[model samples]
Target: MVRKIFRVLLTILGVVTGFFVADSIINSNYIMNLGYFNNMVAKVSLYVFATLSFGIILFLLSPIFYKGVSKLTDAVEKSIGRLSASEIIFGAIGGIIALLIAALFILPINKLLPPKLEILGTVLSIIINTVAVVVGVDISVKRKDDIMALFEGWKKGSSKDKKGKVKGVAKVLDTSVIIDGRIFDICQTGFIEGPLVIPSFVLDELRHISDSSDGLKRNRGRRGLDILNKIQKELTIEVQIWEGDFPQIAEVDSKLLKLAQKLNGKVITNDYNLNKVAEFQGVSVLNINELSNAIKPVVLPGEDMNLTVVKDGKESGQGVAYLDDGTMIVVEGGRKFIGENINVTVTSVLQTAAGRMIFAKQKEV
Candidate 1:
C-alpha cells in the first residue's frame, strides 16, 4: 500500500516537472525560434506529450527506484540503531553548530544584497552550509578530545574526582594468547582483576577454525575454546563476550586492536606481529611471550646448568637444549654429547621478545 502511494506521488511529480520543462522550452527565445515550437498548437501538443511520457516512464521505473531507496533507508537505519547515545548526541551538536555557523556567514551577504539578489544569497547559503558540514567533521576530528571532554563535563559535574581510568574495566583477549592457555593460569592466580573481553568476531574465527578440515587448525581452535571454558567456569575473573564488531576492519588482529582502543583497555596476546602493531598504534598490550620470558630464570655467565642436548643447533657442532620453560640453550662443541646429560656453563644470554637464547659450552671434566 505504501509502495503504491509512493509510485503515484513520483508520477505526479514527474508530470508537474514535465509541464514546467515544456513551458520553459516554449517560452525561451532560442527554442521558440525553432520551426516546431513556432505554432501554438505544436507547443500545446508538446506539453501534453512530454507530461504523459514522463509520467509513464516514472510509473514504470518506480518499483526499481523504490527498492534501491528502501535498501538505502534500511542500511542507514541499521547503522543509526547501532550508534550509542553519546555518538548521537555528538552528531546532533555538530549539525546545530554547522547550521549556526552557516547562518552567521550568510547573514552579512543577505543584508548587503539587493531585493532582486536575495536568491543569490539563498544559493550561497546552501553552498556555505554544505561546506560547513565538511568543515564541522574535520574540526570535530581534530578537536575530538576537547569535544568529548566538554560533553563529559556536562554529564558529570567535575572530572577531578574521577581518575578516568578504564584499565580495570576491560581486558581484551586475542586469539593467539587465548589459545596459548597460559592466560587461564594467570587469571586463576587472581592477577587479572577485571572482566576479560572476548569479541564476537574472534569467537567466530575460532568457530571457523574449529570446523576446519585441517587437523592442526581444528585442534588448536578446539583447545582455545576449551581454555576459554576453563577461564569462565574454573577461574574467578569475569569473562565477557563482547558482541560488538567492526565490520570495516578485515584482520582479526586489527579488529582486536580497534576494540581495545574503543574499550580503552589492554590486549592480551602472544602474537609477535600483533604485539608490535599494538605498540605502534599506542594501544596497551600484555604479551604472554614477554611475560614468560620475564619470569624465566636468569642464567648468569659461568653458571653451571645441567642439560641433555636433544638436537643440533643452527651452527655445526653446536648442541641445542631447551629449558623446561622453553628457553633455548646453544651448547657449543657439544654435538658429540647429544642425548647425554652434561653440565654446561653459560657464556652469554640474548634476550628478545620472541624468547631468550643462551649461548654456552659444555663444562670442563
Candidate 2:
C-alpha cells in the first residue's frame, strides 16, 4: 500500500519536471524561430507528450527507486546504530559547524564567478560542503579515543588503558581461590606479585554467600571474607579493592572474567569449570589448582616414606593418605592399617586432570 502511494508521488514529480523542461525549451531564444512549436496546439501537445513520457518512464522505474531508497535507509540506520550517543551528538555538532564554515567560505567564491558559471560554482560549493561535513564527522568520531584519553589521565582508578579501559597487570582474585586460603600463602612466599585486585562484584557475591541460608555456603563465604581481610592486613603484598563491576552482567563468575579482561590482568581462580570457560573465551587465567599441582613435589617410584593412612580408598584393600601439600597417596594392601602410621613405598605416580595421586604399597617391616 505504501509502495503504491510512493509510485504515484514519483510519477507526479516526474510530470512536474517534464512540464518545466518543456516550458524552458519553448521559451528559449533558439527554439522561438521554430515554426512547429509556434503553433499553440502543437506546443500544448508537446507539453502533454513530454509530461506523460517522463511520468510513464518514472512509473516503470518506481520499484527500482523504492529498493534503492530502502537500501540507503538501512545503511544509514546501521551506521547510526553503531555510533554511541556521545559520538552521534559530537558528530552532528561537527557536521553543522563544518557546513557553516563551508557556507561562509563559498559565498565569496560564488560572487567571484560569472553569471554563466554560477551553476558550476554552486555544484563546487555543494561538493566542498559535503566533503567538509564528512571529514568533520569522521575526524570527530574516529579520534574519540584519543580525545577521551586526554581526560582519562586526570581520573583515577588503576591506570589509563591505551584504548580507554582500566590498564592493569595485577592478579584478579575470585571467590573460590580467595576462600581456599592458599592464595595468601602463595602471596606470602613472594611467588605471586603485588597489587592483587579484588573486584567489588566478587566482594558482593562473597557477602551474599556469607549471609546465605545454606551452612556450607555461609561458611565458605565467611571464610572468603576472612581470607581477604588476612591478605590485606597480614600480607606485605599490595592488595587493591577494585570498586568497579559490570552491573549489566548478572553472574559473578562472568563479572570476574570481564573485570580481568578490562584490567588486562589474569584471573586467579580455583574453579575448574570457570578456568575452562575463561580459557575458551581467550581470557588469561591462573588456576590455583594447576599452580598447586605444578609446584607439588615430584614423587618417584621406589621412594620410601613414613605416612599415616587416613581413610580407605575406593578400591579393595587400599588406604588413602596425603602429603603435607594435600596430594593424595593411595596405599595398596594397607586398608587394615587405617588410623595408624605406616611405612609405605611409592609404587607408581599418576597425574590426572583432577590432581596428582600416588600409588604406594606397605613397606617391609
Candidate 3:
C-alpha cells in the first residue's frame, strides 16, 4: 500500500516537473533576456531535457530501486539491531560536530572563491563536509574517551583529593576480559589502579550473545554480562560503559585497538589472538592470563611442591593436576595415584605464546 502511494506521489511529481520543463522550453527567449542568466537558456533547455529524461528513467526503475534498498535496510537493521537508542543519538551528535567542523573550514573557501568557481566550490564543500562529519562521528564513537576528554579538563580543579601522588593507569576492560571472569579477583586486589571502561558495543555484543540459542555460548555470554553487572554494582572501582564505536571498522577488535591507541590506554583481554593482533598494531595489551602467570608463585626446576593427581595426562602414566588459579601441573609416574595428593619435583616449565606450562615428577619428600 505504501509503495503504491509512493508511486502515485512520484508520478504526480514527475508530471508537475514535466510541465515546468515544457514551459521553460516555450519561454526560452524570454528567459534568455533575464539579467544574471547570461542568455544560457538554450543550454539550460538541453539540461532540462537531460534532467527530465533522467527522472523518467528513475521513475521506471523505482520498483527495482525500492527492492534493493529494502534488502540493504533489512541487512543493516539485523546486524545492528542490538544497538541502543542512546548510542544512535551519541553517534548523531558526533556526526553533526564533525559536519560543523568541516563546514567551518569549507564555507570560508566557498565564499572567497570567484563567482565562476563558486558552484564547483559548493559541490566540493558538500563532499568535504559529508566526509568530515562521517569521519568525525566515527572517531568520536571509536575514541569515546577522546571525545569525553575534550570536556573533562573543565573538572580538573574540582578533584582535590590527591595532589602529589602519581595517578594509577586506567585499564580498558574488553568483553573477553570480563567474560574470562578472572579480572574481578584481579581488581579486588590493590595491584591494578585507576578506572575500568567497558565500551557500549562490547555490552551489546555480550547481550546479543547471551540471547543466542546455543547453550554453551548463551551461558558464557550471560556469565560475562553477570560479571559486568557485578563489577558495576558491587566493586568500589569506577566502571563506566563508554558509548563508542567505529562503524567503518566492522571488527570489535579493530575498534578496541583504535580506542586503546586514541586514549593511550592498555587493553585488558584474555583473548590470545587479540593480544597478538593488538601488539602487532602497536597497541598496548595487558593480557589477564599473562598477569596471572606472572603473579603465580614462582616454582623453579627441582623444587618439590605438593600437588594432587586428579586425572591422567596425554602421555602414558602422567597425572594432571591444577593450581588454585587453574594452571596445569603434569606429574610423571603419578597417574596410578589419581585420587591421591603427593609431592612432585618440578622437572621443567614450558612457556608458550598463550601461557605457562609446568612438568614435574613424583618427588620423595
Candidate 4:
C-alpha cells in the first residue's frame, strides 16, 4: 500500500519537474532578451532548470534511493540499539551542538558574500556542516572514555580525569562475584580501574531474586544491592545501568555472554559457567573467584596450621573451619576440638572450576 502511494507521488513529482524543465527551455531566450532583468532572470532560469532537473532525476531513481535509505536506517538502528539511553542522548546532544556551531560559522559567511558568489558560499557552508556532523559523531564514539571520565570527575570532588587517561572498558560482574562483594573492596583498593557496567537487566534479575520467598536468595540479593550501592557512592568508577538485553537468551549467564561480546570488554564474573561461556564466545573474562583463589595462601599438603573449628562438617565426625580469606577446611576427627583453636595437618586438596577446598586432620600443637 505504501509502495503504491510512493509510486503515485513519484509520478506527480516527475510531471511537475518536466513542466518546469520544458518551460525554462522554452522561455530561456525570451527572459535573456528583456533589459535590466537579463542577468537576474538568467540566474533564476538556471536555478530553476537545475532544481527541476535534479528533482526529475531523483524521482526516476526514487525506488533505488528508498530501498537504500531503508536498509541504512535499519542497520543504524540495530547498531545503536545496544547503547544505553544516556549514551544515546548525550551523543545526539553533542551532534546537534556541533551542527549549531558549524551553522554559526557558515551562515555568516554565506550572508556576507555577494550574490554572484552565493554558490561558492553555499558549497563552503555545506562542507562545514558535513564536517561538523561527521566530527561530532566521531568525537562521541572515540571520546566515550573521556566523556565517562568527565562524568566520573563530576561524581567525585575533582573536575578532571586522573592525568587525562580515560578508561572506557566495561566490567561485567557475575552473581557469585557480586555476592562475594570483593569487587567493592577491589575498587576501594584502587587496584581495579575502569567503568563499572551493571546491566539493568541484571539488576532486575537481582531484584527478583531479592524479593523471592526463599530467605537465602533474598539475603544474597540484598547483599549484592548493598555492595552495588557502596561501589556507586564511594568509588570513582562510573556504574552504568545497562538496559540493553537479548530477549532470546533465557538465562543471565547467556545474556552476560552476549553483552560482553557486544561491548568488547572483559566479563568481571566469578561464575564458572559464565566464564566458560564467555571464553567460548571469544570474549575476555576477569574471574573474581579465580583471582581470590589465586591470591589465597598456597598451603601444600602435610603443612600444619593453626585453626579454630567453628562448626560441624557435612560428614560425620568432621569439623569445618574457615580461614581469614574464607577458604574452607574440613578437619577430620576434629569434632571434639570444635570451639577450640588447634593445629591441623593438611590432608588433601580438591580443586574445581568454582575454587579450591582443603581436607585436613587435627594435629597436636
Instruction: Estimate the Cα RMSD of every predicted model relative to the unseen true structure.
Output: 7.8, 10.5, 7.8, 9.7
Which segments of model 2 are wrong by more than 4 Å?
Answer: 1-168
Provide TM-scores for the models. 0.59, 0.53, 0.62, 0.52
* Candidate 3: C-alpha RMSD after superposition: 7.8
lDDT of each: 0.84, 0.86, 0.78, 0.79
On lDDT, the stronger of 2 and 4 is: 2
Q: Give the top-scoring candidate (TM-score).
A: 3
Q: How many residue pairs clash in each candidate?
A: 0, 0, 1, 0
Clashes of 1: 0
Q: Write the per-residue lDDT of candidate 2 for residues 232-280, one digit (tens) a residue.
A: 8898776777654455788989998887777668999999999999999
Enumerate residue pairs that collide in model 4.
none
